[model samples]
Target: MSAPVIAIDAMGGDFGPHCIVPASLACLAEIPSLHLALVGQTPLIEKLIDRQPGVDRARLQIVHASEVVAMSDRPAQALRGKPDASMRVALEMVRQGRAQACVSAGNTGALMALSRYVLKTLPGIDRPAMMAALPTRAGSCHLLDLGANVDCNAEHLYQFAVMGSVAAETLGVRRPRVALLNVGTEEIKGNQQVKLAASLLRQAPGLNFIGFIEGDGVYRGDADVVVCDGFVGNILLKSSEGLAEMVAEKIRDLFSRNLASRLLGAVALPLLRSLREELKPATHNGASFLGLQGVVVKSHGGAAEDAFQSAIRRALVEIHENLPQRLHGRLEDLLL
Candidate 1:
């Protein structure tokens, strides 16, 4: 098989090419069969590549993009105004079949809008939902509609469940357990939409359809795929990130309080480091825009070298799995 080509928005993230260029180089070194197209201002990307000694130029190429989508740019503004934006150019590469996947740490809203405009949704997919893997006690769980469609109907929620289930299976789960994110586990609880969506899921053919899952149940890994509206899922994701940061800060403070405690901290340092490695958000930094006709992975705007590389790895997995094709084929049997 030929090497998979990934298009990187070299100017999208907070650190831009400074971090992206090096991360791309690192990924190239790690994956010998990978090829990259660095889409951004040609001169700037070229300068970054020149700084690294022994970079395999044959495996990397630069695609010039005149404009950049700012982190603060509204989705509409980016779609209408920035035609030559790095984010858009990278997505275009995927649409044109020049690359198998596109990875960007650009504006999330802009990315979604431009992606819909450029690639369109797969058959039976109304909107492309954002799906990300989150750490869980049992292992990990896939959550979808993370800030994509804030106002969704029962049908939309049902679609998210199907798409999320397909994504989980692609990642190696067999008949992934599916659940709806609700305020309470009882069927009597939750809004009208959740109740209606649950009804649809229960009747759907070939779905695991495990029933309702509360917020805490997500981390407990009660289900392999957790489905929710973008509004709820975004708040849940941000809140979890904030709580993790607070706990880490508290741990640091506790160890630095006194010399005696500091000595004990030294003793426990190895375990703490291991725990941190296990739970670090950077390890799962990419979020897939599921339901799109092409593969596009979104990285956090503030991602550093390692986190951005994680996003690249996520795209590579999707490329290898031919995720868009799998979703399309499954939707025919599962949705229609």
Candidate 2:
């Protein structure tokens, strides 16, 4: 089979060129069959590419872009005005069939807007959702509507759950347990949106609706499919990331306290490593923009080399699985 084409938005993250370059290199090394089209200023990417000794320039290509949409910039305005922006350019690659998938760490709203406009939503999917895989004792669980559709209705949430379940199936989970994220485990606890969605999910066909899941429940390994509106989902995604970082910092601080503590820390190094690996933010790097006509993987804006590499790996996997077709098959509402 031909290698999959990945359009990398090299101008998005805080580290920008630096992170994209190394991450692209790392991804190429890890996945030899992958093809990349780095979307950004050609001169900058050329500099980064040249720094690598004897690297095959043919494997990696650049799509020159003079403009960039800042994260702080308004989504619609930036995307509309900056036609030459790296993110939009990369997305256009998918539209024109130049690439199979696009990876970016740019303005989340702009990315979502451009993707919906260009790729369009699949049949049965009302709006595309951002899906992330979270670490759990049972393995990584798929969490959906992570800031894509903030004002989703009942049907939106139900479809997100279905699409998320399909993704879980790809990850080898059979009959994944689905749960609605609400304040209380009871049916009537949350706002109108959650309450309505809960009822719909409860009656939704072909899903394993495990009822309501709370914030604490997420950490306790409550369910395989965690569903929420984009607003709540975005908050939870960041909150989980912040908590993970804080825990890692606290552990590192304990090891630095004194010589005796350092010795004790050395003894616990293996366990700490396990925890760190388990909680490694990069492990769950790519957030699948579920419901798009095509698969668009969003890498964290502040992602480092490892995180971006993880995004590339995810794009590769999705391409091979023909994820977009499978997702369209499951969520027929998007086509309407």
Candidate 3:
């Protein structure tokens, strides 16, 4: 079979093609069966490609899009104004079956809005959710509703749990332990909505429903999947990212403090490098807008080349696993 074609919004991120072109070439070098459509202004993309020698022209093409969705643009404004934006064009490619998946590091709200408009939700999915994997003691755990449906109901949270389970399984977890993010582990420790959601999750068929997981439990790998409303999920995502940055900065400061510390740092360089690589948010950059009809991975707008590459790989994985199809089946089975 032919390789899956991924349509990328080359001009979407803060650095645009400066970061995307190199990452595309890197991914193509490693993945033999991957084709890429870099959608953006033709001249800019061609210029970057020209600077990079030996790109397989046959496997990579530039699709011109006249407009771009700015990082500062509101979701509603973007949808109405930037009809020819690279982000929308990439989604159109997926809608027309020109690409197996689409990846972007554009405006999060705009990306999510355009995706739902272009791809629609699966049969059983009332609203889509955004999810990503975070490094945990047990390797990694999938966390859902990262920022998609900010105001979700108990049923929505329940659906998130199901979708998160499917995603965790696709990432190689079998019978993932799904849990609701709560203030306390006890059944009655949360708000009415969370308490109600927990009740629904416990009775949810085919879900390995673990009772509740506090915020700290998220890193302890207490559950393979953690489900929460987008409001809370977004806060958690941002806070975790901030904390990671703070810790890395502290480590650097500690190492550069004095001659003795510098000597110790030199000796511990290899171990510190390994730890940094494991903890870097860039390594886990992409977040999937789950429950949509097609595969769409969202890269951080400020991502560098390596981080963008991580997002592309994420899209590839979802495409290979036929995530949407599998998620549909799982939802149907759970509902029945």
Model 1, 163-209: lDDT tens digits are 99999898888999999999899989999999999999999998999
| Candidate 1, run of 10 with poorest lDDT | 275-284
Per residue, candidate 2 scores C-alpha lDDT tens digits across 151-213 of 888888888888888887876688999998989997669888788888777777778889998
Q: Tell me how far the alpha carbon of residue 280 in candidate 1 is from the true structure, in angstroms, after superposition.
A: 4.1
Best by lDDT: 1
Error of 1 at 242 (Å): 0.4
| Candidate 3 or 2, higher TM-score | 3
Candidate 2: list runs displaced more than 4 Å.
Answer: 280-284, 333-336
CA-lDDT, candidates in order: 0.91, 0.83, 0.89
Clashing pairs in 3: none
What is candidate 1's CA lDDT for residue 197?
Answer: 100
- Sorted by lDDT, highest first, which candidate order results? 1, 3, 2
Each prediction's total of clashing residue pairs, residues at least 3 apart in sequence or on different chains, is 0, 8, 0
